[model samples]
Target: MSSETTAASMSTTTASQNPADPVLAGLKTQEAHPVSKKLRYADIGINLSDPVFRGNYHGKQSHEDDFTHVLRRALEAGCEKLMVTGSDLKQSTYAVQIAKDHPGLCYATVGVHPCSAKQFDSYRGGPSALLSAIGELAKRSKASGHTVAFGEIGLDYDRLFLTPKDQQLKYFEAQLDLAVEIQLPLFLHSRAASEDFERLVSARLPQLPKKGLVHSFTGSVEEMKRIVEMGLDVGVNGCSMKTEENIEVVRQIPLDRLQIETDGPWCEMRPSHASAKFLKDAPPLPKAVKKERFSPGFMVKGRNESATIPHVAYAIAKIKDISVEEVCEATWNNSIKMFGLGEVSK
Candidate 1:
């Protein structure tokens, strides 16, 4: 695929499938939600529906207000720091830009996403090129008031078109080496390749100098244990929160290993069972509705959601069956630990 296509794919995030207007109209005719779902926290994940909602939110609309705009929202939502992850050169560069624009409160990740590798021709041009590109990004990440991690670079069995598995592993291992060289933490993303994923890490575990996280995780209890053992953190996001294992894994994790994310402009979260009132049951404006898809009034919200972080805090508390304060503090600490945002953690 052309770089144009890759860039476009990265940019455009829309609803899954346009529904027929009549279907939506009919659903709306019978629309009467049994209960309202309220959002408690921001469970970050990757998505493609809202452009206005995309990017490292700094709070305002302009890029200049990055820190004040994006960081402020996260801060107000109780997010002390936000790590902006990247997929490939462009997005990674954008991420670094966001971090530089926002400074202290905003951080970044540098690496090629599994999905974007094909544009680079499975890095056929060579790994050296990627390394050099990453090195430049890493330098920018090290600039004043920056918090950086190497991430969104891992194996994804879910995306078959992106790369052959062997090539993906080669590139992933290379990024891991970069993470080791930089002595920075990592932000990992894995999908479907669970069976061999750990062994790949195990081979590298002995040589790796630093730890990292598997963002948007959905692994077995055994997998979770292996990750922790390797000195990595878990990016507890809303995407996997709906399943028994997602929340269940959290229950067993030590508080320090639990980090939270909204993967904003992307992944969606679930609503609190109690706060259904604020949630609209319809989809976007009817005119906004492309097809007759059944547009529910509302979906889940996150920490820095349509409301405040307390909702996410509440959601976390409920999922973990712990006090909101505990989840808040632990996640705060975990994020701090993962991104090297030390002083602000307390």
Candidate 2:
């Protein structure tokens, strides 16, 4: 059969399962949600452009079409806006392209991740040259479409597996400077480099823009406090809620300063953590997702997707001693203000 014919067959087979089936029920709940009642959600950081997520990791699945399906599922789960992150020049360009294609629904950030910092020296002209190129791309994206933030940049000491500490710092500071120069909000990442990350962000606070979010924050309460004190927002995801200690740190996050993301196909919430407690009481995975094996982790049996964001909200509600609606409203509003999604809202 032709590729198109095969794809149609698979989609039909996945969709034809009985809705009463346990695995198919959750998808029905998500789909049956009222259109008017569909609360809007903004995923502040998700690598939708990542090849692994687009289905490259799996055999023969068309990731391009899968992104469309993912977006539809996300909408049903209340996520209408997504910020696609770019960890390097090529990825940044791809992110911008995706944002352009999706318009308001998808936005992008353009910057080099600290993990990729070593590549800076090898660029055509080197560090200064790459920075200049990034600046140009940021300008072009801002002028053309939905490029809301300037990052994916910061230090990651946990696995300097590729870039050295010194190089990561060098590139991180350069991107921070670029964010300030461009006057855009920042999407940052920092792991195991809290001391230096805190010091660096603190030093730059005076001139940096008011909107900055530390994505996937898996740090201590003290570190969370410091980040909040510096006027930066905290992004919480499956990664942030991985441990009971992390959950406690999550509890410390003021509602106004907290944002939720899936960081999907990566940070699937483990059952042992607090954030996933709702799953015990929640509906089953959608049958189509199971058939496709979209979720990650053997325990969860699926990779994390934006559609699972409601679980994150449920977890936050349990932790913060507030209603799920309250958590959702706050995070949605936080995302709007932080990412400037509200400016273009209809």
Candidate 3:
């Protein structure tokens, strides 16, 4: 795959390193595969958290500024808008700042991530406290008209930094309860906890939104079918988009039920020599990523190539074997619908 930044450039080498350096992670799926079949949906979820690899901060350095930059790039790439996910209280507030600043261009999902849920005394206290935490977030989301759903809210069995599974479970269920009470769609995340994730989701299946998505989904067709049956639009992004397993899954997923994303400033999509065209649409924005001399969302410069959003879109278009406009329009549409953009989808 083609990437603007090399692998070495993405992982932090030292604590003294610049925090603004754009760290790239990488992939896409969900709205559909055939270019003509992509329904132009919007990306309902995006990671605005600053990555803390080996304890060094390196995701979205300053939420407002970075978000503004990413928002512009997303819009330029043809996304009508997005629903942002915050990392924690501070980050969530910063996300709200972004939402308040750009009412139509951005939306937000409020919840402490599974990884960060431990730090919150409220989350640590119990479901009631978690609800209170969510309540505070809910108020802000309402105030900004951007709390599209409850999200970045799920289990991360893999990253058990300090929080235990039971604690994560409590935190997760608590957030899920909030979604049920508020009657909002959910922006979910699950890493190495699929079976547990399924049990949790299944228990609450009846209470969730008619439509939502499992962000950065990686699962077998059966698992996908289960979630799809529950009415969630599977979010297929760049990282998973290039894989054969992911591709095969994409080939199986019904077109209209799918969606796409960059998960930008993270999940950086690498362009393949074979599938160069599928990597367009993610414009490389590196105000902070300059230290590594790399851009996350797009492939690095050189070989007479520019890693712009349109370029990623082009790459996606070619990979799906569909027209560029179709890919753009459908994913854009999908985003709007997923985020409950309603009349604001324009």
What are the Cα lDDT values of the candidates? 0.54, 0.75, 0.57
lDDT of 3 by residue, 1-346 (tens): 0122212222331112222433211112113123323323355555543332111234433221222234333443345555667756656655565455455555777777788777655446765665686667776676557677677778888889757788788878877777777767777887788888878877776876554678877677788888787777777665556566666676566666766655654555555633344455433332334323544333222211111234445555665677767766666666666565645455
Comparing 1 with 3 on TM-score, the higher-scoring candidate is 3
Which residue runs of candidate 3 sit more than 4 Å off their true CA positions? 1-41, 48-70, 120-127, 272-289, 292-320, 342-346
Which lDDT value does model 3 have at 204? 78
In order of listing, the candidates' clash counts read 41, 4, 63
Candidate No. with top lDDT: 2
TM-score of each: 0.69, 0.84, 0.70
Off by over 4 Å in 1: 1-72, 122-126, 143-147, 206-209, 271-310, 342-346
- Model 2, CA-based lDDT: 0.75
- The 10 consecutive residues of candidate 3 with the worst lDDT sum are 23-32
**For candidate 1, lDDT tens digit of each residue in 97-187?**
5555444444667778776655554455676876778767776676544535676778898887768787787778777777777766677
Residue-level lDDT for 229 in candidate 1: 82
Candidate 3 TM-score, C-alpha based: 0.70
Write model 2 residue lDDT over 238-300, tens digit each, in one string.
888887898899888999999999887678777776667645444344343453444422112
Candidate 3 lDDT score at position 111: 71
